[model samples]
Target: MKTIGRIKTNILSMGCFAVLLSFSSGCGKDDAEDTVENCFGGNWAERYAAELEVYANAVSVYNETPTPANCASYKTAAKNYLDALRSIVDCVPTISRAEINASINEAKAEVDREGCD
Candidate 1:
């Protein structure tokens, strides 16, 4: 669950846009002018990965307390994840799902450290 926390912290600090741009700009996947848009999509995916990881953990966490706010955060995180997914899908060019999945898994340990449950 630390991975959830790590990513969440990164998003909260670095913001949703930062994650998207981090990869796009570094990946060298597009023209400089389109970098902004491409980064937007990429970072959104990153945030989605992090956000979902948290929400998924929250599902089990809420099994313990289940407060209204906690439940709502869970939903908001899940929805943000999904919305980010939709954005990736709607991107002009597709991204590598396998790579993204791998990256998310790499952060699993950190997400676990967040103490979700």
Candidate 2:
């Protein structure tokens, strides 16, 4: 269906966006230090990357089967990915919390539309 295709496209786009954002690195030492300090003394990028991987895997599984259980798992993975992004909003000055929140809400809406809730 067209709706399903659109949902897949949107989810893939979000995943790609997150990947690109997570790879954005600070060019200077000061920026790097500030990122780590602001990111709860940890590597938020690394954490986000890990969550992204989990989300990607879930997407793959859901696409292959689309069972209710897999849908729930996919939703959980999505939440985790969004949570990781939310946790690092302050660390990455380039991306705003509003942007991340919008992505989260959009993803949730898409999932709900698919009856994945």
User: What would the TM-score be for candidate 2 when compared with the true structure?
Assistant: 0.65
lDDT of 2: 0.66
Model 1 scores a TM of 0.40
| lDDT per residue (tens digit) for residues 10-117 in model 2 | 656765665565457543334444454556444455657788789888878988888889988877887777677666666555545577668767876776667653
Which regions in candidate 1 have their CA more than 4 angstroms from the true location? 1-28, 31-47, 92-117
Candidates in order have lDDT scores of 0.48, 0.66
Q: Give the TM-score of each candidate.
A: 0.40, 0.65
Model 1: ten consecutive residues of lowest lDDT: 10-19
lDDT for residue 20 in candidate 2, whole number 0-100: 64
- 48-116 per-residue lDDT for model 1 (tens digits): 566657766765665456676565565466445544544443332346555444444444434434443
* Clashes, model 1: 14
Which prediction has the highest lDDT against the true structure?
2
